[model samples]
Target: MKKYFLKLYQYNYWANKRVLSALTSQNVSDEKILSIMGHVVAAQYLWLHRIQGLPPAEVKLWGTYNLPQLVSMAEEIGTRWLQFVESTDNFDRELTYHNYTNDPYINNVENIMIHLVNHSSYHRAQIALLLRQNGFEPINTDFITYDRVITGQWKD
Candidate 1:
Protein backbone atom coordinates (compact mmCIF):
# COMPACT_ATOMS: atom_id res chain seq x y z
CA MET A 1 0.00 0.00 0.00
CA LYS A 2 2.78 2.40 0.86
CA LYS A 3 4.58 1.62 -2.37
CA TYR A 4 1.41 2.19 -4.36
CA PHE A 5 0.82 5.47 -2.58
CA LEU A 6 4.38 6.52 -3.34
CA LYS A 7 3.84 5.95 -7.03
CA LEU A 8 0.66 7.99 -6.88
CA TYR A 9 2.50 10.82 -5.21
CA GLN A 10 5.28 10.56 -7.74
CA TYR A 11 2.81 10.73 -10.58
CA ASN A 12 1.22 13.70 -8.86
CA TYR A 13 4.50 15.55 -8.60
CA TRP A 14 5.27 14.83 -12.24
CA ALA A 15 1.85 15.89 -13.43
CA ASN A 16 2.07 19.14 -11.48
CA LYS A 17 5.43 19.94 -12.99
CA ARG A 18 4.09 19.31 -16.45
CA VAL A 19 1.14 21.58 -15.79
CA LEU A 20 3.36 24.29 -14.38
CA SER A 21 5.68 23.98 -17.33
CA ALA A 22 2.81 24.31 -19.75
CA LEU A 23 1.61 27.36 -17.86
CA THR A 24 5.02 28.98 -18.08
CA SER A 25 5.87 27.92 -21.62
CA GLN A 26 2.56 29.16 -22.95
CA ASN A 27 2.64 32.34 -20.87
CA VAL A 28 -0.63 31.42 -19.19
CA SER A 29 -1.62 34.40 -17.12
CA ASP A 30 -5.28 33.70 -16.84
CA GLU A 31 -6.57 34.63 -13.41
CA LYS A 32 -8.85 31.60 -13.16
CA ILE A 33 -6.11 29.15 -14.01
CA LEU A 34 -3.69 30.72 -11.57
CA SER A 35 -6.32 30.76 -8.85
CA ILE A 36 -7.06 27.07 -9.31
CA MET A 37 -3.38 26.20 -9.24
CA GLY A 38 -3.04 28.25 -6.11
CA HIS A 39 -5.73 26.21 -4.42
CA VAL A 40 -3.89 23.07 -5.45
CA VAL A 41 -0.73 24.33 -3.77
CA ALA A 42 -2.47 25.64 -0.70
CA ALA A 43 -4.46 22.49 -0.14
CA GLN A 44 -1.34 20.37 -0.27
CA TYR A 45 0.35 22.53 2.30
CA LEU A 46 -2.72 22.63 4.48
CA TRP A 47 -3.05 18.86 4.43
CA LEU A 48 0.65 18.39 5.00
CA HIS A 49 0.48 20.43 8.14
CA ARG A 50 -2.53 18.50 9.32
CA ILE A 51 -1.02 15.05 8.87
CA GLN A 52 2.14 16.25 10.56
CA GLY A 53 -0.06 16.82 13.62
CA LEU A 54 0.17 20.55 13.41
CA PRO A 55 -2.75 22.89 13.61
CA PRO A 56 -4.09 24.34 10.44
CA ALA A 57 -3.07 27.89 9.66
CA GLU A 58 -5.05 30.49 7.84
CA VAL A 59 -4.18 30.18 4.19
CA LYS A 60 -5.74 31.22 0.93
CA LEU A 61 -7.19 28.16 -0.72
CA TRP A 62 -7.81 29.95 -4.02
CA GLY A 63 -5.38 32.65 -4.94
CA THR A 64 -3.00 33.65 -7.70
CA TYR A 65 0.75 33.29 -7.55
CA ASN A 66 3.40 34.28 -10.04
CA LEU A 67 4.65 31.44 -12.20
CA PRO A 68 8.08 31.35 -10.62
CA GLN A 69 6.76 31.49 -7.10
CA LEU A 70 4.17 28.84 -7.80
CA VAL A 71 6.73 26.54 -9.37
CA SER A 72 9.13 26.90 -6.47
CA MET A 73 6.52 26.25 -3.82
CA ALA A 74 5.06 23.35 -5.75
CA GLU A 75 8.42 21.63 -5.99
CA GLU A 76 9.20 22.31 -2.36
CA ILE A 77 5.88 20.89 -1.19
CA GLY A 78 6.20 17.89 -3.48
CA THR A 79 9.59 17.04 -2.02
CA ARG A 80 8.27 17.45 1.50
CA TRP A 81 5.35 15.16 0.79
CA LEU A 82 7.64 12.47 -0.60
CA GLN A 83 9.82 12.72 2.46
CA PHE A 84 6.87 12.62 4.85
CA VAL A 85 5.40 9.52 3.32
CA GLU A 86 8.74 7.79 3.02
CA SER A 87 9.66 8.43 6.62
CA THR A 88 6.37 7.38 8.11
CA ASP A 89 5.53 3.75 8.89
CA ASN A 90 1.95 4.09 10.03
CA PHE A 91 -0.66 4.59 7.36
CA ASP A 92 -3.75 3.69 9.34
CA ARG A 93 -3.27 6.19 12.11
CA GLU A 94 -6.26 8.47 12.29
CA LEU A 95 -5.69 12.22 12.23
CA THR A 96 -8.03 14.98 13.23
CA TYR A 97 -7.85 18.31 11.47
CA HIS A 98 -10.05 21.26 10.90
CA ASN A 99 -10.95 22.70 7.55
CA TYR A 100 -10.42 26.35 6.69
CA THR A 101 -13.96 26.98 7.82
CA ASN A 102 -13.20 25.58 11.27
CA ASP A 103 -15.09 22.40 10.59
CA PRO A 104 -13.50 19.36 12.14
CA TYR A 105 -12.99 16.01 10.45
CA ILE A 106 -11.08 12.80 10.93
CA ASN A 107 -9.22 10.70 8.37
CA ASN A 108 -6.41 8.23 8.26
CA VAL A 109 -2.96 9.04 6.93
CA GLU A 110 -3.41 6.85 3.86
CA ASN A 111 -6.80 8.28 3.00
CA ILE A 112 -5.41 11.77 3.24
CA MET A 113 -2.70 10.87 0.80
CA ILE A 114 -5.24 9.40 -1.57
CA HIS A 115 -7.39 12.51 -1.25
CA LEU A 116 -4.47 14.71 -2.13
CA VAL A 117 -3.76 12.78 -5.30
CA ASN A 118 -7.39 12.74 -6.36
CA HIS A 119 -7.84 16.38 -5.47
CA SER A 120 -4.87 17.39 -7.54
CA SER A 121 -5.95 15.29 -10.50
CA TYR A 122 -9.45 16.76 -10.40
CA HIS A 123 -8.08 20.29 -10.54
CA ARG A 124 -5.51 19.45 -13.16
CA ALA A 125 -8.28 18.31 -15.43
CA GLN A 126 -9.99 21.61 -14.82
CA ILE A 127 -6.84 23.43 -15.74
CA ALA A 128 -6.58 21.41 -18.93
CA LEU A 129 -10.10 22.33 -19.92
CA LEU A 130 -9.49 25.98 -19.19
CA LEU A 131 -6.33 25.91 -21.26
CA ARG A 132 -8.19 24.44 -24.18
CA GLN A 133 -10.92 27.05 -23.84
CA ASN A 134 -8.22 29.67 -23.97
CA GLY A 135 -6.79 28.35 -27.21
CA PHE A 136 -3.83 26.50 -25.73
CA GLU A 137 -2.91 22.82 -25.92
CA PRO A 138 -3.04 20.95 -22.65
CA ILE A 139 -0.17 18.70 -21.74
CA ASN A 140 -1.15 15.12 -20.97
CA THR A 141 -0.75 14.44 -17.25
CA ASP A 142 -2.54 11.11 -16.96
CA PHE A 143 -0.97 8.52 -14.66
CA ILE A 144 -0.50 6.10 -17.58
CA THR A 145 1.22 8.90 -19.45
CA TYR A 146 3.62 9.32 -16.57
CA ASP A 147 4.22 5.57 -16.40
CA ARG A 148 5.02 5.40 -20.09
CA VAL A 149 7.39 8.32 -19.67
CA ILE A 150 9.04 6.47 -16.81
CA THR A 151 9.19 3.14 -18.66
CA GLY A 152 10.73 4.66 -21.84
CA GLN A 153 7.58 4.22 -23.86
CA TRP A 154 6.93 7.91 -24.30
CA LYS A 155 7.75 9.44 -27.69
CA ASP A 156 8.60 13.01 -28.26
Candidate 2:
Protein backbone atom coordinates (compact mmCIF):
# COMPACT_ATOMS: atom_id res chain seq x y z
CA MET A 1 0.00 0.00 0.00
CA LYS A 2 2.79 2.37 0.83
CA LYS A 3 4.53 1.55 -2.43
CA TYR A 4 1.33 2.08 -4.38
CA PHE A 5 0.76 5.45 -2.76
CA LEU A 6 4.33 6.43 -3.47
CA LYS A 7 3.81 5.59 -7.14
CA LEU A 8 0.66 7.69 -7.10
CA TYR A 9 2.47 10.59 -5.53
CA GLN A 10 5.19 10.42 -8.14
CA TYR A 11 2.62 10.23 -10.92
CA ASN A 12 0.76 13.19 -9.47
CA TYR A 13 3.92 15.26 -9.33
CA TRP A 14 4.85 14.41 -12.90
CA ALA A 15 1.42 15.26 -14.26
CA ASN A 16 1.30 18.51 -12.30
CA LYS A 17 4.62 19.62 -13.71
CA ARG A 18 3.54 18.85 -17.27
CA VAL A 19 0.35 20.82 -16.90
CA LEU A 20 1.99 23.67 -15.05
CA SER A 21 4.61 24.01 -17.73
CA ALA A 22 1.86 24.32 -20.33
CA LEU A 23 -0.02 26.80 -18.17
CA THR A 24 3.06 28.94 -17.83
CA SER A 25 3.69 28.85 -21.54
CA GLN A 26 0.32 30.41 -22.21
CA ASN A 27 0.98 33.37 -19.97
CA VAL A 28 -2.11 32.52 -17.98
CA SER A 29 -3.47 35.17 -15.64
CA ASP A 30 -1.62 35.40 -12.37
CA GLU A 31 -4.70 35.19 -10.20
CA LYS A 32 -6.20 32.16 -11.90
CA ILE A 33 -2.97 30.17 -11.87
CA LEU A 34 -2.25 31.05 -8.26
CA SER A 35 -5.74 30.05 -7.21
CA ILE A 36 -5.46 26.68 -8.97
CA MET A 37 -2.04 25.97 -7.53
CA GLY A 38 -3.14 27.06 -4.09
CA HIS A 39 -6.13 24.75 -4.25
CA VAL A 40 -3.83 21.78 -4.89
CA VAL A 41 -1.53 22.85 -2.06
CA ALA A 42 -4.41 23.33 0.33
CA ALA A 43 -5.83 19.89 -0.47
CA GLN A 44 -2.50 18.22 0.33
CA TYR A 45 -2.17 20.26 3.49
CA LEU A 46 -5.68 19.44 4.62
CA TRP A 47 -5.25 15.70 4.16
CA LEU A 48 -1.83 15.73 5.76
CA HIS A 49 -3.23 17.61 8.72
CA ARG A 50 -6.08 15.17 9.01
CA ILE A 51 -3.72 12.22 8.92
CA GLN A 52 -1.59 13.74 11.69
CA GLY A 53 -4.57 14.80 13.84
CA LEU A 54 -3.81 18.44 13.26
CA PRO A 55 -6.28 21.30 12.97
CA PRO A 56 -7.96 21.89 9.65
CA ALA A 57 -6.44 24.37 7.28
CA GLU A 58 -8.22 27.58 6.36
CA VAL A 59 -9.85 27.62 2.95
CA LYS A 60 -8.06 29.33 0.09
CA LEU A 61 -9.18 30.58 -3.28
CA TRP A 62 -9.31 27.92 -5.99
CA GLY A 63 -8.27 28.20 -9.63
CA THR A 64 -6.11 31.16 -8.68
CA TYR A 65 -2.48 30.15 -8.44
CA ASN A 66 0.31 32.34 -9.71
CA LEU A 67 2.61 30.17 -11.80
CA PRO A 68 5.77 30.68 -9.80
CA GLN A 69 4.08 30.54 -6.41
CA LEU A 70 2.14 27.42 -7.28
CA VAL A 71 5.23 25.64 -8.55
CA SER A 72 7.14 26.50 -5.39
CA MET A 73 4.32 25.41 -3.13
CA ALA A 74 3.91 22.17 -5.04
CA GLU A 75 7.58 21.38 -4.66
CA GLU A 76 7.50 22.05 -0.94
CA ILE A 77 4.41 19.96 -0.39
CA GLY A 78 5.83 17.12 -2.47
CA THR A 79 8.93 17.11 -0.31
CA ARG A 80 6.88 17.13 2.85
CA TRP A 81 4.79 14.23 1.59
CA LEU A 82 7.89 12.21 0.76
CA GLN A 83 9.25 12.88 4.23
CA PHE A 84 5.99 11.84 5.82
CA VAL A 85 5.94 8.65 3.80
CA GLU A 86 9.31 7.68 5.19
CA SER A 87 7.69 6.86 8.52
CA THR A 88 4.63 5.12 7.12
CA ASP A 89 4.24 1.47 7.97
CA ASN A 90 1.94 -1.12 6.44
CA PHE A 91 -0.37 -0.83 9.43
CA ASP A 92 -1.09 2.77 8.54
CA ARG A 93 -3.67 1.68 6.01
CA GLU A 94 -6.00 0.61 8.83
CA LEU A 95 -5.81 3.78 10.87
CA THR A 96 -8.95 5.90 10.97
CA TYR A 97 -9.74 9.55 11.48
CA HIS A 98 -12.53 12.08 11.17
CA ASN A 99 -12.47 14.72 8.52
CA TYR A 100 -13.17 18.38 9.14
CA THR A 101 -16.81 17.74 8.24
CA ASN A 102 -16.96 15.13 11.00
CA ASP A 103 -17.26 12.24 8.64
CA PRO A 104 -15.68 9.05 9.93
CA TYR A 105 -12.98 7.61 7.70
CA ILE A 106 -11.20 4.29 7.68
CA ASN A 107 -8.06 3.13 5.87
CA ASN A 108 -6.74 6.40 7.16
CA VAL A 109 -3.36 6.59 5.49
CA GLU A 110 -4.05 5.09 2.07
CA ASN A 111 -7.46 6.69 1.78
CA ILE A 112 -6.16 10.13 2.63
CA MET A 113 -3.25 9.73 0.25
CA ILE A 114 -5.59 8.58 -2.50
CA HIS A 115 -7.85 11.51 -1.77
CA LEU A 116 -4.95 13.89 -2.11
CA VAL A 117 -4.01 12.46 -5.50
CA ASN A 118 -7.56 12.30 -6.81
CA HIS A 119 -8.45 15.71 -5.48
CA SER A 120 -5.51 17.32 -7.19
CA SER A 121 -6.16 15.41 -10.42
CA TYR A 122 -9.73 16.65 -10.50
CA HIS A 123 -8.76 20.29 -10.02
CA ARG A 124 -5.81 20.12 -12.34
CA ALA A 125 -8.15 18.82 -15.02
CA GLN A 126 -10.38 21.76 -14.31
CA ILE A 127 -7.49 24.13 -14.81
CA ALA A 128 -6.63 22.37 -18.05
CA LEU A 129 -10.21 22.66 -19.19
CA LEU A 130 -10.17 26.34 -18.43
CA LEU A 131 -7.04 26.71 -20.49
CA ARG A 132 -8.58 24.78 -23.36
CA GLN A 133 -11.74 26.89 -23.33
CA ASN A 134 -9.54 29.94 -23.55
CA GLY A 135 -7.89 28.59 -26.75
CA PHE A 136 -4.78 27.03 -25.22
CA GLU A 137 -3.91 23.37 -25.69
CA PRO A 138 -3.94 21.50 -22.42
CA ILE A 139 -1.36 18.79 -21.98
CA ASN A 140 -2.50 15.18 -22.05
CA THR A 141 -2.81 14.18 -18.39
CA ASP A 142 -4.39 10.75 -18.40
CA PHE A 143 -3.17 8.26 -15.80
CA ILE A 144 -2.12 5.74 -18.41
CA THR A 145 -0.07 8.40 -20.07
CA TYR A 146 1.69 9.04 -16.81
CA ASP A 147 2.27 5.36 -16.24
CA ARG A 148 3.68 4.83 -19.67
CA VAL A 149 5.98 7.79 -19.39
CA ILE A 150 7.22 6.88 -15.96
CA THR A 151 7.46 3.12 -16.32
CA GLY A 152 7.92 2.73 -20.07
CA GLN A 153 4.93 0.46 -20.27
CA TRP A 154 2.62 0.81 -23.26
CA LYS A 155 -0.95 -0.39 -23.27
CA ASP A 156 -3.13 -0.80 -26.28
Candidate 3:
Protein backbone atom coordinates (compact mmCIF):
# COMPACT_ATOMS: atom_id res chain seq x y z
CA MET A 1 0.00 0.00 0.00
CA LYS A 2 2.85 2.37 0.77
CA LYS A 3 4.40 1.59 -2.57
CA TYR A 4 1.11 2.24 -4.32
CA PHE A 5 0.72 5.60 -2.58
CA LEU A 6 4.30 6.49 -3.38
CA LYS A 7 3.70 5.86 -7.06
CA LEU A 8 0.62 8.03 -6.95
CA TYR A 9 2.56 10.84 -5.35
CA GLN A 10 5.36 10.47 -7.88
CA TYR A 11 2.84 10.65 -10.70
CA ASN A 12 1.30 13.71 -9.10
CA TYR A 13 4.66 15.42 -8.86
CA TRP A 14 5.55 14.52 -12.44
CA ALA A 15 2.25 15.67 -13.83
CA ASN A 16 2.54 18.98 -12.03
CA LYS A 17 6.03 19.56 -13.38
CA ARG A 18 4.89 18.80 -16.90
CA VAL A 19 2.03 21.23 -16.58
CA LEU A 20 4.27 23.91 -15.19
CA SER A 21 6.80 23.37 -17.92
CA ALA A 22 4.18 23.55 -20.64
CA LEU A 23 2.82 26.80 -19.29
CA THR A 24 6.20 28.32 -18.64
CA SER A 25 7.64 27.27 -21.96
CA GLN A 26 4.83 28.99 -23.76
CA ASN A 27 5.10 31.98 -21.43
CA VAL A 28 1.45 31.74 -20.49
CA SER A 29 0.23 34.69 -18.48
CA ASP A 30 -3.39 33.83 -17.86
CA GLU A 31 -4.51 34.89 -14.45
CA LYS A 32 -7.01 32.10 -14.01
CA ILE A 33 -4.46 29.41 -14.79
CA LEU A 34 -1.94 30.97 -12.43
CA SER A 35 -4.53 31.23 -9.67
CA ILE A 36 -5.55 27.59 -10.03
CA MET A 37 -1.93 26.46 -9.96
CA GLY A 38 -1.33 28.54 -6.88
CA HIS A 39 -4.30 26.93 -5.21
CA VAL A 40 -2.92 23.49 -6.04
CA VAL A 41 0.41 24.37 -4.44
CA ALA A 42 -1.31 25.77 -1.37
CA ALA A 43 -3.54 22.73 -0.98
CA GLN A 44 -0.62 20.32 -1.19
CA TYR A 45 1.18 22.15 1.57
CA LEU A 46 -1.95 22.35 3.71
CA TRP A 47 -2.65 18.63 3.46
CA LEU A 48 0.93 17.63 4.24
CA HIS A 49 0.99 19.95 7.21
CA ARG A 50 -2.28 18.51 8.40
CA ILE A 51 -0.94 14.96 8.10
CA GLN A 52 2.07 15.98 10.19
CA GLY A 53 -0.23 17.31 12.94
CA LEU A 54 0.70 20.90 12.23
CA PRO A 55 -1.65 23.78 12.83
CA PRO A 56 -3.89 24.62 9.89
CA ALA A 57 -2.87 28.26 10.06
CA GLU A 58 0.74 27.44 9.36
CA VAL A 59 0.01 27.43 5.65
CA LYS A 60 -2.58 29.34 3.72
CA LEU A 61 -4.91 27.03 1.83
CA TRP A 62 -5.78 29.63 -0.85
CA GLY A 63 -2.88 31.94 -0.84
CA THR A 64 -1.89 33.83 -3.98
CA TYR A 65 1.50 32.81 -5.38
CA ASN A 66 3.24 33.51 -8.64
CA LEU A 67 4.35 30.75 -10.98
CA PRO A 68 7.99 30.75 -9.89
CA GLN A 69 6.97 30.71 -6.26
CA LEU A 70 4.53 27.90 -6.92
CA VAL A 71 7.16 25.88 -8.76
CA SER A 72 9.52 26.20 -5.81
CA MET A 73 6.79 25.31 -3.35
CA ALA A 74 5.76 22.28 -5.40
CA GLU A 75 9.32 20.98 -5.57
CA GLU A 76 9.83 21.38 -1.83
CA ILE A 77 6.51 19.81 -0.94
CA GLY A 78 7.07 16.95 -3.37
CA THR A 79 10.34 16.11 -1.69
CA ARG A 80 8.73 16.26 1.73
CA TRP A 81 5.88 13.96 0.67
CA LEU A 82 8.27 11.47 -0.89
CA GLN A 83 10.31 11.38 2.29
CA PHE A 84 7.26 11.07 4.51
CA VAL A 85 5.75 8.27 2.49
CA GLU A 86 9.04 6.41 2.41
CA SER A 87 9.47 6.64 6.16
CA THR A 88 5.92 5.94 7.24
CA ASP A 89 5.04 2.35 8.16
CA ASN A 90 1.44 2.88 9.19
CA PHE A 91 -0.87 4.29 6.57
CA ASP A 92 -3.81 3.72 8.86
CA ARG A 93 -2.53 6.20 11.39
CA GLU A 94 -5.36 8.65 11.99
CA LEU A 95 -5.10 12.42 12.19
CA THR A 96 -7.42 15.09 13.51
CA TYR A 97 -7.79 18.42 11.78
CA HIS A 98 -10.22 21.23 11.24
CA ASN A 99 -11.80 22.14 7.95
CA TYR A 100 -11.65 25.59 6.45
CA THR A 101 -14.92 26.31 8.20
CA ASN A 102 -13.41 25.27 11.53
CA ASP A 103 -15.34 21.99 11.57
CA PRO A 104 -13.32 19.15 13.02
CA TYR A 105 -12.84 15.72 11.49
CA ILE A 106 -10.59 12.69 11.76
CA ASN A 107 -9.10 10.68 8.91
CA ASN A 108 -6.37 8.18 8.30
CA VAL A 109 -3.15 8.92 6.45
CA GLU A 110 -3.98 6.86 3.36
CA ASN A 111 -7.23 8.65 2.71
CA ILE A 112 -5.56 12.02 3.10
CA MET A 113 -2.91 11.12 0.56
CA ILE A 114 -5.55 9.93 -1.87
CA HIS A 115 -7.51 13.11 -1.39
CA LEU A 116 -4.42 15.23 -2.08
CA VAL A 117 -3.79 13.54 -5.43
CA ASN A 118 -7.43 13.75 -6.45
CA HIS A 119 -7.60 17.39 -5.47
CA SER A 120 -4.58 18.23 -7.62
CA SER A 121 -6.00 16.32 -10.57
CA TYR A 122 -9.27 18.21 -10.28
CA HIS A 123 -7.53 21.57 -10.48
CA ARG A 124 -5.09 20.46 -13.14
CA ALA A 125 -8.01 19.53 -15.38
CA GLN A 126 -9.39 23.01 -14.94
CA ILE A 127 -6.04 24.52 -15.94
CA ALA A 128 -5.91 22.29 -19.00
CA LEU A 129 -9.34 23.39 -20.07
CA LEU A 130 -8.45 26.99 -19.55
CA LEU A 131 -5.31 26.63 -21.62
CA ARG A 132 -7.27 25.03 -24.44
CA GLN A 133 -9.99 27.65 -24.32
CA ASN A 134 -7.33 30.30 -24.63
CA GLY A 135 -5.87 28.72 -27.77
CA PHE A 136 -2.97 26.88 -26.19
CA GLU A 137 -2.06 23.21 -26.29
CA PRO A 138 -2.11 21.72 -22.80
CA ILE A 139 0.38 19.00 -21.97
CA ASN A 140 -0.80 15.42 -21.49
CA THR A 141 -0.85 14.76 -17.76
CA ASP A 142 -2.58 11.42 -17.50
CA PHE A 143 -1.26 8.72 -15.16
CA ILE A 144 -0.66 6.30 -18.03
CA THR A 145 1.38 8.99 -19.75
CA TYR A 146 3.58 9.36 -16.70
CA ASP A 147 3.91 5.60 -16.41
CA ARG A 148 5.07 5.32 -20.00
CA VAL A 149 7.68 8.01 -19.50
CA ILE A 150 8.94 6.52 -16.27
CA THR A 151 9.08 3.00 -17.65
CA GLY A 152 11.03 4.05 -20.78
CA GLN A 153 8.11 3.14 -23.01
CA TRP A 154 7.83 6.66 -24.34
CA LYS A 155 10.37 9.07 -25.72
CA ASP A 156 10.44 12.82 -25.49
| Candidate number achieving the greatest lDDT relative to the actual structure | 1
Model 1: per-residue Cα lDDT over 37-104, one tens digit each = 88898899899988887767345787668888789989998998889878877788888878888898
Clashes of 3: 0
1 versus 2: better lDDT goes to: 1
Q: Give the local distance difference test score of model 2.
A: 0.73
Best TM-score goes to which candidate? 1
Model 2 scores a TM of: 0.78
Evaluate residue 103 in candidate 3 and report its C-alpha lDDT on the 0 to 100 scale: 91
Q: List TM-scores for all candidates, in order.
A: 0.95, 0.78, 0.94
Writing each residue's lDDT as its tens digit, candidate 3 over 1-156 gives 988988999999898888998988888888889889988878888888778877663555666667888788888888888888989878888888887778999988889889989999999999999999999999999999999999999974
| Candidate 2 lDDT tens digits, 36-148 | 76888767877776677677755453445567877776777777777777667662556577655679867657666787799888888887777778788888878889888
In what order do the candidates fall by lDDT, top score first?
1, 3, 2
* RMSD (Å) of each candidate, 1 decimal: 1.3, 3.6, 1.3
Give the runs in model 3 whose Cα sits over 4 Å from its true position: none
- By summed lDDT, the worst window of 10 consecutive residues in model 2 runs over 57-66
Deviation in angstroms for 28 in model 1?
A: 0.6
